[model samples]
Target: MSRHIDLAVIGAGPAGARAALEAAHRGLSVTLLDEQPKPGGQVWRAKSAAILDAPPTPETEAGNRLRQSVQDSRVTHLGEARVWQIERAEDGWKLHVLRDGRSSPLRARALVIATGAREFVQPVPGWSTPGVLGLAGATALFKQDLALPGQRTIVSGTGPLVFFVAAEIRRLGGAVAAVITPNSRGDWLRVLPGMLQRPDLLARGVSWVADLMLAGVPIHWRHAVSAVDGGSAVEAVSFRKLGADWTPTGEARRMSADSLCLGNGLIPTVEAAQLAGVELEHCPELGGWVPRHGEDGTTGVPGLFLCGDGAGIRGAAAAEIHGRLAGLSAAQHLGADTRAERARLHPGYVRAARFGMAMTALSTPRAGLAQLTTEDTIVCRCESLTRAAIAAEIAGGANSTNAVKSGLRAGMGACGGKFCQTAVARMIAKAEGRAESDVPPPTARPPLRPVPVAALAGDFDYFDLPIPRPAPL
Candidate 1:
C-alpha cells in the first residue's frame, strides 16, 4: 500500500522543516522525512541527552525553537526514514522508503529536496588513515556524543568550518595542538568587508578566533597538510606553506597529534535532484554544480522544487528562506494562493544569498590543492585507486568523469560517489586541460542509496515469485 500526500519534503534541516511547516500552514497535507531521529539537520541536530542540559548556543537555541514548532504543527514528520529512490509517476512522484526494516511507498503531488551539503575533503597522502576525519564529522562527535576526536588535535582545512570546529574542540575541553590553513590573514582580510555585511555573524566568527588565542593556540596561515603519517592510525601530520594556488612551496613541518580534522569546504548534495531530472550547471561560487531553478525554487520539472544546501551552498539562514519560498511555490503549484507570501520573502533571500556567496567564494578550494596529492595517494578510497592510476586512466582515454568511473570503478563504491566524485572530476579536468564542468558528473541511477535485498524482496514466496523462462538457445 502507498501513502499519499499534498507535498513531500525529503529532509528535515532548517530548510526542509520550515518548508513542511509553511505548506502545512496553508492547509496542505505535508509530510517531512529525514534520516535523523529528529529535525535540525546537521547544523541544528539535537544534542545528546548527556549534554542536553549544557549551556545552549545560538544554534542550539534556534534549533530548539524550530523543533518545537514542527512538533506542534500540522506537518507529519517521519524520522529515521531513508528515501532510497524517487521516480516520476503518472500522477506525481513516487518515493521508495526504507523505515524500520520495512519498505513502503510514498506518493506526493509535489516534492522538495533539502538533502543539504557535504564536506569536500581534498586527498592528501594518508588521508584515508583511520584517525583522519572531516571537520564536520568531528563537530558531529562534539554535538551528538559530547566526545572529542583526540586529546591533542591538529585542525587543518579551509573555510569558516575550520575555525568553528577548532573552537568547538576547546569548548568541549579537548586540547587543540594548532590550527593550520591555506588562507593567510591577508587573504581573509580581502573578504572582511563582505563578511562584515553580516556583523552578527562576524562577531561570532571573531569569538571563535578569540577563544583559540586565549587558549594560546598557534594559528598557521597559508599552510596545508602535506601528508599524514602513521602505520595504523594518525601518529603525526606534515604541513607546508602553500603558493597562491594552494600548491605546497616551503619546507614541510611535522606536528605530532593523535588525530587530524581536515576538510576543504562544502559542496551541494545534488544526487537526489539530479535523479529527479532537474537541470544542473557548474557555478563555482555556489560550490560546484547546482540545480538550475528560479528564485521561487521552481525547477524545469513541473512539480519538483529544490531548496537549501542541496540546491546550492548558501548557509543555513539563506537555506531557511530558500525553504520558505519553495514551500510557498509548491503550495501555489498545487493550487494554493501564495503569491503574497512569496513576494514578501524574496528580498531577504537575495540579501542572505549575497553574503553567503561571498563566504563561499572565499572558501572555495584553490587549484593548488590538486597538487597536494602524490602519485600513490589514494584518490578513491572505495576501490583503492591512486592519483596515478586515475591520471593514467585519463591519459588512456577516460576524458569524462563517467568514463573514468567505468574504466577504473572509482565511483562505483558503496558511497555512490559521494566522497570521490568531485576529486576525480578535478583530476580529469586538470589532465585534459578542460573546464571542470566539461567533465560532467556520472549519470545518476536509481535506488539512490544502497538497499538491503531483503527489504526490497518483502515476503514473497518461491511459488509466487515471477520467475522468467530461459532465452532461446
Candidate 2:
C-alpha cells in the first residue's frame, strides 16, 4: 500500500524544512524526509556532541531556531529515510523509499526537491590518503562531533570555506599549518559587487579571516596544493604559486602537517532533481550544473519544484527564503492564493542569491585544476582507476561520461558518480579538445542510490511468483 500526501519535500535541510512548514501551515498534508537524523541539513546540521560547549555563532543560532520550529511543527518528519526511486503517478509522483531496511511507497500530490549541494575536490597527488578530507567533511566533524582532523592540519582549497575551516581548527585548539588557495586576491576583488549585497555575510567572512590572522596562520593566495605526502596518512602538503590562468607557476614549497583539508568549492547535488524530471543547465557562476527553474522554484514540471542549493549554489540564508517561495508556489499550484507570501520573500531571495553567487564564482575551480593530477594519480577511488587509465578510455572513443563509464566502469562504484563524474568529464573535454559543457553528465537512473536487494524484496515469495511460459519452438 502507498502512503499518500498533499506535499512531500525531499531533504530536510533549510529549504526542505521551511517548505514543509509553509505547506503544513497552509493546511496541506506534508512530509519531510532526509537521510540525517535531524532537519537542519549540512549548513545548519544539529550538533551531536555536548562536551565541547562550543560558543554559539550566528550560524548555530539560526540553525537552532530552524530545527526547533520544525520539531514543533505539524509536518511529519522521517529521518533515516532514503528514496531509492521516484517516478510520475496518475495524480503526482511516487517515491520508493527504504527505511529501517524495509521498502515502502509514498505518493505526493506535490513535490519540492531541496537536495542541497556537495563539495568539489579536484584530484591531486596523494589525495586519497587516510588523513586527507574535503573542507566540508572537516567542518562536519567539528560541527557535529566536536572532533578535529588532526593536531596540525593543512587547509588547502578555494572559496570562503578554506578560511572558515582554518579558523574553526584554531578555535578547537588544533594547529593550522597553513592555508593555501588557487584564487588570487584579484579574483575576490572582481566579485566584490555581489558580496556587498549581503553585508552581514560579508562581515562574517571577514571575521573568519580575522580569526585566522590573529592565530598567526599563514594565508597563501594564488597558490594550489600540488601533493599530499606520507605513505598511508598525510604527513605534509606541497603547494606552488599559480599563474593568471590558475596553472602552477613557481617552485613547489613544502609545509609540515599531519592532515590535509581540501576542497575546490561546491556543486549542486542534482541527482534527485534530475530523477524528478527537472531540467538542468551548466552555470559556472551558480556552481557547475543546476536545475532550471523560476525564482519561485517553479520548474517545467508541474507540481514538481526545486529550491535551496540543489536549485543553485546560494548559501543557507538564501536557501531559507528560496524554500518559502517554493512552498508558496507549490501551494499556488495546488490552487491556493499565495501572492502575498511570494511577494514578501522575493526581495530577500534575490539579494542573498547575488552574494552567494559571487562567492561561488570566486571559488569555482579553474581549468588548470585538471593539471594537478599526474598520469598515475587515482581519480576514481572506488574503482581504483588512475588518471592515465581514464584518459586511455577517452583516447579510444569514449566521448561522453556514459561512454567512458561503459568502457572502464569508472562510475560503477558504490558512490555512483558523485565523486568522479566531474573529473572524468573534465578529462574527456581536455582529450577531445572541447568545452566541458559539451560533455554532459551521465544519465541518471533509478535506485538513485544503491540499496540492499532484500530490502527491496518486500513481502514476496519466489514460490508464488508468476512464471513466464516458454516461447513456441
Q: Best candidate per TM-score, number? A: 1
- How do the residues 1-473 of candidate 2 rate in per-residue lDDT, one tens digit apiece? 27889999999989999999998888998999999988888888778757436787666777788888988888999999898899999999999888999989999999999999988888988999999989999988877887899989999998889988998888889999989988888888898999999887788889988888887888999899999899878888899888877888768999989899999999899988888887779888888888899999999998999999998898888999999999889999998899998998899889998888888887777777788889999999889999999998888899999998888888878988788999999898898899877887888887788899988888777889888999899
Q: Give candidate 2 misplaced runs (Cα > 4 Å).
A: 49-53, 460-473
Error of 2 at 40 (Å): 0.4
RMSDs, each prediction? 2.4, 2.7
In order of appearance, the predictions have TM-scores of: 0.96, 0.96
Shift in Å, residue 338, candidate 2:
0.4
Score each candidate by Cα lDDT: 0.89, 0.88
Q: How many clashes (backbone atoms < 3 Å, residues ≥3 apart in a chain or on different chains) does model 2 have?
A: 0
Worst 10 residues of 1 by lDDT: 188-197
State the lDDT at 16 in candidate 2. 90
Instruction: Please list all clashing residue pairs in model 1, or write none if there are none.
Output: none
